[model samples]
Target: MIQDYLRQQVESKDYQPVFYDLKNAQDLHTFEALLKSRPYIRINDEIYSQLRELMKIRNPTKRLTAAEYDEKVQAYLDGVEIEKFGVWVYYPWNNQVVHLVNEADFIELRTSRNQHKITAAEIAVLSKKKIGIVGLSVGQSIALTLVMERLCGELRLADFDRLELTNMNRIRCGVHNLQVPKVVIAAREIAELDPFIKVKIYEDGMTEANMDDFFTAGGVLDIFIEECDGVDIKILSRIKAKELKIPVVMEMNDRGMIDIERFDLEPERPLMHGLIPEVDIPTLRGLTDAEKLPIFSPMLALDNASARMKFSLGEIGKTITTWPQLASSVVLGGALVADTCRRIALDQFKNSGRYYVDFEQLIV
Candidate 1:
């Protein structure tokens, strides 16, 4: 009976490889070449047209002939460093880039929408700021969104958890990624997106011993994102943030709630706005599910939580194994955190309070 049950469980599982492993030095060389190569003219006519479109240059308005456009394209390409290995990135992925461009040019092209909204000066300011993120499950979305928007030059990430089959519901990865450390996955994604930006990882996740290093290991953070479920780190991080005067942002990922604590402006502010002012790390650590629910409910603002989420919370460790999170909600959390961090870093707003992007209310 036991053997039959185990076989049934194994049969029910769906397993497939998603990402190609970098096995040898050749693979490394190809990846390096892809990172180093600059965007250059592959086919002259095609590249010329692309450059004209990208630059929004047209004849008769900011009139430039084909030759003139070609010259401009060449000038841009000249600035990119030549690939040392001359290797190309060829994987099972949908698209491939023969030549890579400078990080700045690539970012500029990718973040055109953001550029349109904010001034170049604002972007320059954002590029200089360093941001730290703890808990890569939902934090992964926030990190990627920040990178895509070019919000910061450096990112510090901490998460000791490994990716599991269960994490696939919200995390944007494939089955093959199971068992990979969350930090490694996030770092690889960021590096592939923009190699110029620096990423510091704490593979052990934030703890009493390493939490200090995560905050002040390399450079002081302009903004700190707290998303880990660890009750101890959650409280301890805020204490440190208050001491350093760094701004803090968090997303509940349930009911689309966002919490902003401007420790920078209000150094005396209690952790989580004093929601659990008396609860210390010792009391929080090693809490049972039943014991944790009381504190967790208030911290997440259960009174304001959606009906579905509130219902789900009640089922934890019962019918449900854990708190349920939707991909839509997780993705929304990323956008909320990114926008809040950007506004704070740019000094455009200094409000410290809780905000919501509740989908239930919004959709209705």
Candidate 2:
């Protein structure tokens, strides 16, 4: 039975897959031509009724005749060049072209209710900013949330780690993606979600050599998100960010702690709230688990950590293998970081400091 199921899954199908790099002008043109060749407009009954009502409103003094309504519908269809506009996304996984509406229409429809909350002008501001996220563990959630909200025009992702079965606990992915680089998995998912947004990948991860490039290489990032586990990177990234005058944001999945450093506003701000004052990159990299606890505990403020997390940290090299993180906490961290990034980018909030989205505190 299992063999039969496996066989069925791999069997070839009648549908031939088509792939295209929409980034290329020729490929995009080809996609547009294909869409035009077999033009399709699917309007449900409800939308048809709405269209009729809209036609009636065109002339309030006189009710629209059936023939006039039909003419208006036809004119509306004639005006729509379905092929000419829209972001054409070619998904290599399934080999399909997912056509999304053009930018203006897309933004307006997708964020219609967000008008009073985020304001149209604020959304336009977010669309121009570029954000870079290093580390795709907790960073995965942050990346997806940002894309869903249309927070930035482009994203830069860096992570040397691959998707292992162990990562499934926090990183949202399927079993088929095992061993694939985290950056590739994230980029592919982002493309499927919004291919119009540009994504640049740093597969090698952020290192001392490429630290400068990661922060300022492609385009000056409006915001930098740091969520990796490397202590060296934690320190080195901030140094570069401070020098480049870019704001930095980080989320600790435990206890829902968020750190926002607005180096762009205060270049003299200490890294990690002055927790690792005198430590250099090499020194931080060489510290052992026991040796590093003193520094980390202070920064995390272990006294304020959740009971489970505090206990888990005490068992690092003993019974427990590593620090504990939950999907719940990671998801919350994503939301927290997204909101912080949005507020910071929009210039609505100016104070830079430590923040907690602790469920323990909020639930009560």
Candidate 3:
């Protein structure tokens, strides 16, 4: 019955439902607070009874008087979706509710007291999106940030390595996840965090051998976040994405700051791809250390002023992975990623190219 109601809500929007799971206590409390503040979320008598009982059981001394409960229920009654009644109580283990609404209209319904400005309805739009993640150190932070924001429906996590203790300083995984594949650990966290969210992990990550299959096989990824460390891999991914017309995003965390790039704005956009395609493998092998440094060094469009200011790359690198900077940058990166994803999905972001974040001077 609950499924049926959910189906109706989804069908009315001409979208299909892929994931539906119950929320945990913390999420439920958060949801309840959201509902209470909306003033427009109606609860039928049956549902009200259940909610009241939950409140009473959870806080016996703070139980609402019958009069007060009735009054509150009455206020929300006018906003009830009569046809969609009673579906919110489907999962009992967790009073929290998470649903992938097929339609964008529902984005208006998701809200929390802490973030009342955002609605679950808006998050649903995010859920319909799929993003490719290409690295695991800062990639871990990127993944966590996206999932927490409820920004994308599915995440395509690509990493070639296993978790090591050395990575604990910056990665999302911990001692319990050591030795586990980065993709596996990230997937487990995603499922536990939101069962309805879909996660596709590429344990081998992306490579010349498998890149074609990964990109062309499943649905086309809406955008890509490239965190892979190898210069060749980054170069190849950028060129291929341009050819395939998929947008690829990359970021570098300089000391406590981040620099992001969006390559392949138009289908025929130019190639910023580094080493593989045009140059033969032998030529790549022949390059000396002096030649290779330029290939690996980031290309900047910095103004003469910015370029003139010389700073040590080693110090910049050290600062980004440090405490407050690392944490702030990760959060900032995720928020930016979320905003970018939203614009792309809604067709609101007209231009697509590169974006840089310099935390040191708060410059972008």
TM for every model, in the order presented, reads: 0.79, 0.79, 0.60
Number of the top TM-score candidate: 2
Q: Write the per-residue lDDT of candidate 2 for residues 254-332, one digit (tens) a residue.
A: 8788988899999899876787656665778766666677767766567778888888889988997678778998899
- Overall local distance difference test of candidate 2: 0.77
Say which candidate scores most in lDDT.
2
Give the root-mean-square deviation of each candidate in angstroms: 7.4, 6.2, 12.9
Clashing pairs for model 2 are none
- lDDT for each residue of candidate 1 in 1-364, tens digit (9 for 90 to 100): 9998867742111111122123346766655555467334131113334455555422336867677776766665565422321223232222334333335555565566665587778888999999999999789999999998889999998998988988989998877567778887887677667656788888789888987787887788999999988777888898889999999999999878899999999989887878864666687887776677788777768888888877887888889877887888889999999998888988988988899877678879
Give the runs in model 1 whose Cα sits over 4 Å from its true position.
1-66, 75-98
Candidate 3, residues 174-270: lDDT per residue as tens digits? Answer: 5866677787777766664554566777778888887876666667777777777565666777767777777765554543323333443566555
lDDT of each: 0.75, 0.77, 0.56
Candidate 2, which ten residues in sequence have the lowest lDDT sum? 10-19
Model 3: lDDT equals 0.56
